[model samples]
Target: MTRPRYGDLYFGLSDSRNEANQDRDSFLQTYVDLNGSTKRVVRGDKFLVLGPKGTGKSALAWYLQFAEPEGAHLALVRDASSLPLAEVPRLQTGQEPGPERTVVAWKFILLCNYLELLMRDQGCSINRNPEVVRVARLLRDFGFMGDASGRALLKFSTTTVTIPVPKLGTIYKRESSSALNIFNLIPYLEMWVAEAESAVRHILLIDGLDSIFLNDAKYDESLSSLVQAAYTLNQKLMENRATGSVVLLLRNDIFSRIALSLPDSQKMRDDLALELDWRVLSGKAGVGAPLMRLVNTKAGRALGVDNFEVLKYFPDSIEVGSRELGVRKIPTFQYLLNMTRHTPRDMLRLFEEIRRVEASGIFEESGDRLRQEVIHEGVLQYSTKYFVGAISNEFAGYAGGPERAAAALTALKAINKQSFDGDEFRESLASVASGIEVDHRDLLRLLFYAGAIGNSIGGYREKSYMQFYHRRDESEIYLQGNFMLHNALIHAWGLRRTLGNEPESQTGAIPLIDRGAARPRRRRRKWEERKK
Candidate 1:
């Protein structure tokens, strides 16, 4: 059999870092947890992994579910956008269930999934286990599949309980005499866990909660329940030792929304939750070195090697401009990362695009040695262009669907400026008649959060950067600064970035991307010119 060439091997690259392809091998081979903090956190009993979209929330969940640590049985739950959670009782009497009862519902739902897993593992029919059967039946009544595998349970928990759950204060007194035996699934789960203790510890990895807990008011109450559930369930499992754990992988934006009204919000944020961040700067370095390491790992896998030094595949620096124009050298990874919003998924997609572009044989290819290959300028440009489009798609859901967000990007590109003041941005925004109907302020906030732009404050000397996820609790920060779109977007947007102490006004003077520039007007013919 003939061995595959480097170009053919690059075909395994995934375009997007989503869990849409749940192949265990696909996940294990290239997965890298920046600092290993996320891995340690997930291995624990209870915790929440919070991050913005495309920061590897689902990827981590997929890792936990498929490549779980030793001595643990990881059960992944996904497709939460179709969950049937609305039927879960939000009200006990005439009052909505307090945080405790809300916690109970989450525990009950989690246990149902766990029991289903245990039943499937035992190969005994789900019907044989009365406890599991009862809980499954209850879930079925709420429009879920009683006999489905634990993974399929993700479909039934999409919508959350609305705030001020209607009839909470009214329906309670009428049902005050009710025996809550049916609602108590924890005890059954506890008994099952005790029996299974000698076997393996189980963990329920709940993913896609970001979609389930939309910031909309209707989801506030339901999201609160999940927060409380993490706290309460962990406490129970910690004490029992027989039970496994539950890890909720959610977006930081959604977590912030859920934490706002939750009483134990501080505990969750400061204690129980582990944030999956790629923006953390170490020592005095502003860039995410960890993300670079992550990219190296992916690159290593792509090259079919164990070495992960990125420079081996790409040059340490690239020289630009002619001798007359003062040629300068730039760090390769620094340039790549600066163009990115600093997310692992973004870097992965960028590298994947680079490989795809290289596959076209547009650049010179190296010999039998894999590490000798070089990703040329054309590949970088193509990848960056592809990344810009992916950014809009990544945040489209956050902007409340794709069409409007797509329009917003279209309008932004047409305005064609890299830096903007509040007044100037608003004026430019008004020129675009298409796209979403958001005000300039809201549009900026959305773009900042989506990583399309960054907030530049304190001017050149003490330049401080603020992203949408930065100071999430402070709403006032949105309207306070001059804005700069990311350098990664420079070419795609036909804009340029002027680094250092340059004034904002002078910054826009830099040359626009020639390829992205508007087509020039044709010279009129002599006869046609006479008519004019």
Candidate 2:
């Protein structure tokens, strides 16, 4: 009898953003409703969606953007980091200071932008609405849509403008109108909106915020302004019970850094924040149900099978027992999760690699289960290789650029030691080949956040779990003197895994590490430098 062959299993497995842009039908099929997030957002109950990188925040945003409900209109703000905050007139009363003014400015900006988008879509005119006409005229004059004057407007400490509306008998005192405060005209705008079609709900989606404020003060301030804008807009809607919502999709890292400084940040978190955490509360668990549900959703839809039975398509296990060359017995899904950073992207990434290896014919096909070599070497190397490359690219915009982070990852890979003591780890990093002087502590913190290394604190079991960071007040690394490379990456990094605290002698082949020095810088250069 002929041996049964493994069929192609990988079907459009990837991060949701890619799926959202490339494959709409498959993206929708694989999308799972995470705890009624779609419902809450559509109902206009929540406006702030927060999560760490790769926690499906963008996916949710894109889902809502395409899945507009019956009575709601969605307007997507593709890039919030580049929002024209300077174009909005700030409130300058003694009680409302700079920050308060900024909040009001953001509210004004959202309202006008939404109105403009709505009008453009419906092919209607704001000519009948005096307040909108005034706001639109000012926004256009200031170059709200990429005007040089817009940059000038951002630098203005105060603005003064005079508007004459004979129909409404509204005239600003020339002396008192030194600043164009939009809040002063709010009553008129509200009146206009209340009288207009009140049934059609308007939803604004603000996305593409990741990697925006890495280490730049200008970008940071811009993000803060966007957050403020969302908050102010929400408050305005709630006050009038308006049929509009402004949703801000942000990374947890970015939000955490800015939330403490903003006055109403707590109110937003308590009332409107939706954290897209995929990990379970228990530390020992390999994977959470939410992450698995996402995987199953995609796999089932792709393979034309039931989502609950996704495990049937995968190998039963990667290893059977503690013995060397253990027969493949551990389920492949759990094994993959154990090596992951507990993210859907990582999970899908590993599966994509598996499919690639299977297609490459690197190892002989043996039924449907992956061979030990294929599972350990091919899949692990692929995942870790891409993950390390991504980190290098992520840190490429900072002071030292990609080399700063790549040097750390390379040092770890070259050391080729799976688990090490605090002193040993510190010594290894210090003795790395690269001459660049990354702070030893900063190197560890970087690795911890990147999910390259995990800590051991007596009871916790995940080799890559960095509980120390979570426990710290500032999310800094608190090394417990012992750490282990993630089991999945250990093989790719040419490091040995341990059995009962003893190093296994049969470590897989080591792969070459990219030192990151020769890589070209891709971040935007300064103006003078760009001129050259």
Candidate 3:
């Protein structure tokens, strides 16, 4: 068996939807089912998938919508970014802008989508049912043949319609003077759904909510309402014995804000949410880990090999050293994984950089595997570009957010240390604090939430640990504890070791001490004590 050239290898697109769109076959084939997420979605056990950006939330959604073995399921993806969400709250029946009215609006839109699906899939059968036919005609008259805009759907809501109930021999009419609206159509839509005989289960996937995120009350209310509407609509489907469900893909931070405004947030999280956290365990960062397995699967498919070992295409170990622990060799996979925030997109970006480096031929390679220098260069490039860009994009929705984030990063870089106590961090940002709208503490929290920095919990004696916001969405950032910049951003920011003053190398190559070797050294006993 011959090995494939590095130039010929494919690491998949960083965007999940792009990969699905451009390479449908490969995308479906290489999708890693971490924690049986696809299965859970198929079973309607989970409807909400929450995670920080690049944690594969969208990947899981696209997989559910397009992966083969559809067996008894018809999945459709509706990207929320394409929908006019801002116009949704305006369509509220009441004068106030709140989630209640928006929830009703979302229900109407979702119901229209379901009706369109039924018309497309179970058209002949649904036409036989008077209620389903009436509902379909109502939606069709409003220009909802699928892919209708929010404004279009709003038109459907406000338009008065009279439907003749053939079975009851009476006309169900809405007076031109009355306030009858979309909410009134909900019961009829639910009736149609309950009565229609569709053999396959309908799964509606709502993704790309992050694309249209804005830091405002209305945006928050609209998003929160969408979640509530999905939950309520799904419950109605289940209660009415309709084999259908609605799944929402949301970023953890956005979901956190929505959760705060929601009264039953905990209950919804417990019953409806499936967090796509792929943080690998200390002992399990090897071949079997989800991130590594995903890479292996994609590499295998790209190379036309079955059961490809990731280490086969990369070095076994990389040299790492620190003052706390002498020079030691750590697994290359672990080293690479540490450079990421435990997300598949991070790994994919890293590999994509490696491929680019390989194609450039700037580093000498043995033609069998990626050289340590190549991987280091790839990490540097990925950190400086993709990682930092991702962090900037995370906070871009807020006012002065991008500038403030850049200023905060500059302050961190000026501090020139990997880890710092709260005061040092606060002091470092003081010079740039004037331009930033948020207080120093709020800025710290923003950095924490973006996965740029994390609290350093525990002490050396207890095996010091780092807790990132992405890993613990429910946990708060306590400024009382020490904080460490994420490894992925260390190179980009040119941070130094916590104990030393030396700046990080230009390639961002800091010798990280192996976690196992970072234990507190035991002091040698005195001679007298030994004699005793």
- Among these predictions, the greatest TM-score belongs to 3
lDDT of 3 by residue, 171-213 (tens): 2453333333465656767677656676677677888786654
Tens digits of per-residue lDDT for model 1 on 235-254?
66666664356777777766
For all predicted structures, in order, the TM-scores are 0.73, 0.75, 0.82
lDDT of 2 by residue, 19-56 (tens): 76787767776677678887787677889888766667
Cα error, residue 202 of model 2, in Å, equals 2.0
Error of 1 at 126 (Å): 11
- Candidate 2's displacement at residue 236, Å, is 1.3
Tell me the deviation in Å of residue 284 in model 2.
Answer: 8.1
Ranking by TM-score: 3, 2, 1
Question: Which residue pairs of candidate 3 clash?
Answer: none
Candidate 1 residues lying further than 4 Å off, grouped into runs, are: 1-23, 34-43, 68-72, 84-104, 123-142, 145-198, 211-213, 282-288, 301-305, 320-327, 366-385, 394-400, 434-436, 459-476, 496-532
Q: RMSD to the native, candidate 1?
A: 12.2
Those runs of model 3 whose alpha carbons end farther than 4 Å from true positions after fitting are 68-72, 83-87, 94-99, 122-124, 129-148, 152-179, 212-217, 252-257, 260-264, 280-285, 320-328, 421-436, 459-464, 500-532
Question: Global lDDT of each model?
Answer: 0.53, 0.57, 0.69
Candidate 3 lDDT trough over 10 residues, lowest sum: 515-524
| Candidate 1 residue 119 C-alpha distance from true site, Å | 2.3
Worst 10 residues of 2 by lDDT: 510-519
